[model samples]
Target: MTPMLKHFRYLSTSGIPRPFRSIPGPLSLPLIGTLYKYFPVIGNYKFSKLHINGMKKYKQFGPVVKEEIVPGVNIVWLFDPKDIENMFRCEGKYPKRRSHLALEKYRLDRPNVYNTGGLLPTNGPEWWRLRKIFQKGLSSPLAVQQFIPGTDDIVTEFIERLSLIEGQNAIDFLPEISRLFLEMMCLSVFDIRMDSFSDNELYKNSRSTRLLKSALTTNSCILKLDNGPQLWRYFETPLYRKMKKAQKYMEEVAIDLLSLKMSIFKDRDENSSKSLLDVYFSYPELDFKDIIGITCDFLLAGMDTTSYTTSFLLYHLAINPRAQENLHKESVRLLPEWNSPVTKEVLAEAQYAKACLKESHRLRPISVGVGRVLDQTAVFSGYEVPEQTVIVTQNQVSCRLEQYFPRPNDFVPERWLKDTPLYRQGHPFLLLPFGHGARSCIARRLADQNMLILLIKLSRNYKIEWKGGRIDTKSLLINKPDGPILLKFERYQC
Candidate 1:
């Protein structure tokens, strides 16, 4: 049955959709739904603060509980894997993930800046079309592999740069790695050299740094305007205003760079060594504005997630010395020579290293879970959910649950080894950090390669140890270390 028809039937049979309303959830007060039931609202300023207590919601509400962020929007949190399977399967060829309402507003307000939708907010045929074109650019195995030599040099140079930080006073490691990722991303995606450590380098005024600064502003705006009060939609709040400025800066810079590149590439003949920009230039169907939009999305995602994940892996290794030792053994055996280049085939040999990265991801996921706005009504966990409801796969909660994993609290990378009885067989649906189906991250391979190379090199050169007691995670757009992660690194002696 159609979700709309089902909803209509339920409404006509009863004054309201009792089945929908009957779903277990927090108390919903008038306009704000059940937000006030768990959060604080002081005067004009109101904060749902979901990021700080996201897992708590799953605990307070059951496996399939209703949450109304505002009057119209209803979010259903599903921890059961069965329900997640249905939702993912129900998502048609072009999966519909959450659309950033604030970003949509920006696109509407400035048609010139955001002429066409990019991956983040685009859906249906438009999303599918752009996704295919985008896949050809980044997702293709050939695309990322073509740049391996460049990516390897970038990582090797970053390790050299990282080594310079040794013997210095205890320092916050997050910002340091964030820069490395940013530099690597720029080199890979834009064909831009962004090494600030080079004697002739200028970071503050460089195009890469400028893009990073503008992206930070735009991201902060999206988080506030996207997750903030619904009332912000009516007025131009300070955040929205800042978002406009940031987006404009981003658009202007992108158009200028893309236009200049197009002009430069216009004179050159077709060649096999085309960069991503070159690939886009080859496609006559793509609009200049769209090229800018896709590039912007690349810049946005490229900045944070991989760096955050790498930091967490390092942290896990530092805290769990046994895991670190195990990884060291694996690294030494697979890579007897520490300075070797990491190709996909070579990376496949480093089983323990991959397991360590996976363990860190399971423990500290970037988001609470993957979200899919359903287009069809489907049964989830024995309940009939209506259409257009945001179904969240709370893997962050499920990954740690003892029911799915034995001794879920312990950081055991060996649990991922194939021969062990602890190895899970068929739970891909339960543990998706980058999401699943067609909507999975386009940069999955690129990000994975980046993290693996950096970690392998890092472990080879130094023994990482966490001096500060238990660090917390903060979830905004990305889940990351809450504060400065103080860790001690010693040079490995022969």
Candidate 2:
């Protein structure tokens, strides 16, 4: 074992007090630190250097090793499931790190619901407040029930779109699925009909959406440098102008929707309990801009993540024909017909279908993991993590750990079954596809439900096979299939 791992193991077994165990690993460089090494190469591909190196570093340092990504930024990488649990329990004490370059660029000029704060990105008391408000909408059994029709409609539309692509045809599932999901998000959350697939104006002005989509995929030191005040001022070029224009387009779309929602709310009777926007507006003290920010947060978070995950699921299913058969069998047994809307009851019974999704997420999580900034100095194992230190748990790696999974590299849905030892010892925090802790994904239920429903519907209707008998996975902010997930769909005959 490496010194870092030895140190971590010692800390775990030793009865040392909190705040005393020194965090192990290398020191940061004066200014650029490891950023020059890690950031320069993370260009617009599927996986970040941080993620690639993080797994390598963990192998060398053990579960609780510390490393410097940049000067003064000490990142503690936690790989052990036990360590993950401890960190999650301490999450409120350790909130989300400040917005990074990409987030800042996106949010710098925008006004919407997140202006007040939302669950996935926000932290502190403000996050708690917004989460409470958002939870009321998401967690309400009635509200979730109400959302079913919209979700069903969108997923059905998505399957129909998939049907148009013939066998072995190379298609970019990224943009196509992104548009489908954005439509679903709007319909489900705001009762708004984006119909982006059909609307020319919406399609034409969606440059901001395109940019955001591209930003997530492309790698650039220039993009990173542009976020820094000093560097950004010195490098006022066309690329910067393009980003600014994109940001403006994004803001316009958000504001337009916010204004429309507000006008409708204004005209409605106080007693009308119709949409999520109406419910939110009922609370008179909350500002409209904040509402818009939070709503947009939902829109952005929901769209990219679900679409990317669904894409990954489709790719995996296309490649693994036996897994596809298992999924199809499960779907047929549970919801034999695809004509009806997928209900929670039907989804709950689709055991293998759910397992396939869980396994897919396990292998190719949207994010490598979530990051939490230490609110104050804290100790993990035998290390002192200073205040403002960024702590990241490798959920992707955890899913592959032998302690948590048997044959971690293989896709086996039966492994998640209740009687299995894997299920018994499974670490909730470690297996988080939606993350864990005080700032866990608020849209967890919605994202989960949507993915499962889409899978169930797709599997029942079509037998998905890969083009030329090969599949490739890629990583951006979210992991997805590299090429358009090319597939031949043989329609199921009833």
Candidate 3:
């Protein structure tokens, strides 16, 4: 029998609707279907980058296409901004992300230990409650503004730390940026600096850093399971053991930190200072384990995404000297001092710098797209998508289209300057790396301020020159630099 015949033979009677199947994609094979689309060989690499592969299929199949990660698991991919907006509006009260099966399983396996799955997994009333409990802290504008000075101090110290490198050799900058971002996040979240380099023994290479590492590693392990079959859950795989062990370590550390904070909260004056930690502590009803889980979630999300985005931003500025020079000119014209405490007022004045960052986000979003698991049926691309289906905004793909961006791949921050047609005509939904609506990233404000501050300080002090090969990216959820991000930064003469 032919391959198409064999596939149809095995396909369930009500499998995929004929109309839906006709949307656009490669020929679905006997059993693997469009899985071959993911593995199309290019040079030496094969199926290594999922999002890039998705884009190739998007080009083949029109704006809306269908791809399967595995057999029987069908997903509708969207590239239109209008469809993304519709999908966002259709996300009911408690929007679910395509739920992380491994993370949810980890929570369920330790039900007593994790009574309420934190913000990422839980939905319905449970998610609503969890979100309400922490949103004020995680999404607070005031908290972000308050954090600026402290984070600025860290950014400065990080720049200075970079100078200590002995040679002109290319720096493997990812870990350095990760460490600095973690320190800032620690100070913001726990009101404690999580630094690797410190004068005091207690502060140097802190336990919090270790716990954060474990959390990230465990998350990576869990996501690995997510990409593969479900048989790992039944088997005692080494990977599973390591993840569970890391999870346990994270829980223990969280309990210890909670006790320490609780002890301090009793004697400490309420007006001492405000922080994300203070906000979490205010909700005493929240379980200790869940708080730890949320902390881990925030650390993992907060550290890498912001740092990698900033790194990629610098990569662009490095390659485009004109953008960097323009940004510096803006900063010099707008601010009295580059190293001073960053305020909202300063951020406002650095509009062009902000635009440059926005341009980078448009060109190279950390995540290729964002999704919401629908709660109600919605019509999209002339199809009636069912309830509980995952609707993704291919933001990366949408933002890159020439029809929308007019030379999409090129880095042109000027297009973002006011009075430009591209600036006036672009829809807000065209490039949402963070996401949109009430379900958007809680740390958006924090991420923005962090990037803006880094851009200002880095542009002020150094000339970023790209010493790396082609800038390539890989994503589990948030994309990170796939190759060595080698750059040369010469101190500014001015």
Candidate 4:
């Protein structure tokens, strides 16, 4: 029997779907809700082990779990693909989801520096407006295609740098990948090469390192404040203060980059094609502060998402030699020579490469899942959920379950390819790496192009091997690798 048929054999959706109240989850008290369940000694769940906790919840609750995470704020977690589809379908024209409350508070506290809470936190009309402008040049395939040459240029330089440390015992590639993504994002968003890979004393203390450090600091701070109590809301907590300092540095750097780009725009020929930054600048709806906010948002969003995803992708390739060889075969077929320029046409034929990425995403998604606050009421698993209720889709859990993908724990890229016998025609919403719908990731195309080009180039050059312990994820607002990504890179011989 086929994997799809096998998947069907495990199906147990019997009887009528339970009501909203019947959705199983941990107990919730009046003021603290289910917050006590995560407290020390008394609590069963650990905030650091949220990903593990999600798996435990799935086993206990059987797909649909609802809990009031905080007082008066109830969240319905959907692990079933069918219910995930229902949740998204209920998302109206302006799909709304809860943002980083701490980040929003930070932005709102400083009205002069930020016009809105940026893209990740803002909702309603402001989000719609920003998203529309963001989609102008960043969303389209062709738009990202324009940067293929530039992205490949950065990747080629990075691969050459990797060659220097080829024979190292175990290379901690997370930092290496982080630097590569930073350079790529700089070239794509700012139309400038950060040259972060260059071994220069000046580069060490320059804007690139500073910006990356600030971003990391801010991410750590936000994670600490978001998961815990609302202590930051009451006063400037130490972590909050540190985040503000890092954010302040980020704001200064963004304004500087904006100024630099604007000055360059003044002298450039009108016939020259506009860059992503130029496209944002052209939008009259946004002012200077808004541009700064958007630039900062892109910087923050681009850094970790693609870099972390690439790290896991490489890890998957490292441990699974068979899969890596298959990818190497695909890369060798398309890229005849090392440092071959990755063009839009070449990427079109790299199906296996794309499948490898999809498989990696299935295993190590950047976030546990995407969440939404529906505009209208919807029925999920026959439960009549109310409007404006936050519905979090447990995609991380579902994607790994046998019910959706057969041999879900194994790294098998063939499952994503239709011609393979191992393929399962699973639910369309089973794997949402870039998410779905209008309110999905704004830089989805750009991130994909960036990583695809890098993967193709890397596979053609080196055979990745992992000789370390299993790397898992730790939830930090978003999912991040729990430990260092240690790998060995040996130059491939023809």
Candidate with best lDDT:
4
Clashes of 1: 0
Model 4, 1-494: lDDT tens digits are 98434422333234443557877889889888888988889988877666677888989877778888777777888888888887777787888878577888988888988888988888888889888888888767888788888888888988888878897877788888888898888787888777776666136567778888788777767755765567889998898889888888888888887889999988878777667888887778889888878888878778988988998898888889999999999999999999788889999999999999999899989788888997766667666677899998989888889877889899999998999898778898978977799888888988988999999999998988897789887776666788889988889886
Query: What number of clashing residue pairs does each candidate have, in the order they appear?
Result: 0, 20, 0, 0
**lDDT of all predictions, in order shown?**
0.72, 0.66, 0.72, 0.83
Model 1 TM: 0.89
| Candidate 3, residue 483: how far the Cα is off, in Å | 1.1
Task: Give the range where candidate 4 is weakest over 10 consecutive residues by summed lDDT.
Answer: 4-13
List model 2 lDDT by residue over 286-314, tens digit each: 77666766765665567778877888888
Give one digit per residue, the lDDT tens place, for model 3 in 309-330: 8888988998998989988887
User: TM-score, each model?
Assistant: 0.89, 0.84, 0.88, 0.93
Off by over 4 Å in 1: 1-18, 37-52, 196-210, 267-272
What is the descending lDDT order?
Answer: 4, 1, 3, 2
Candidate achieving the largest TM-score: 4
Clashing pairs in 1: none
- Candidate 3 has what TM-score? 0.88
What is the C-alpha lDDT profile of model 1 across 68-162, one tens digit per residue? 76656788888877767778876767788765667667776767666665788888898888888877877666668777777778777776666
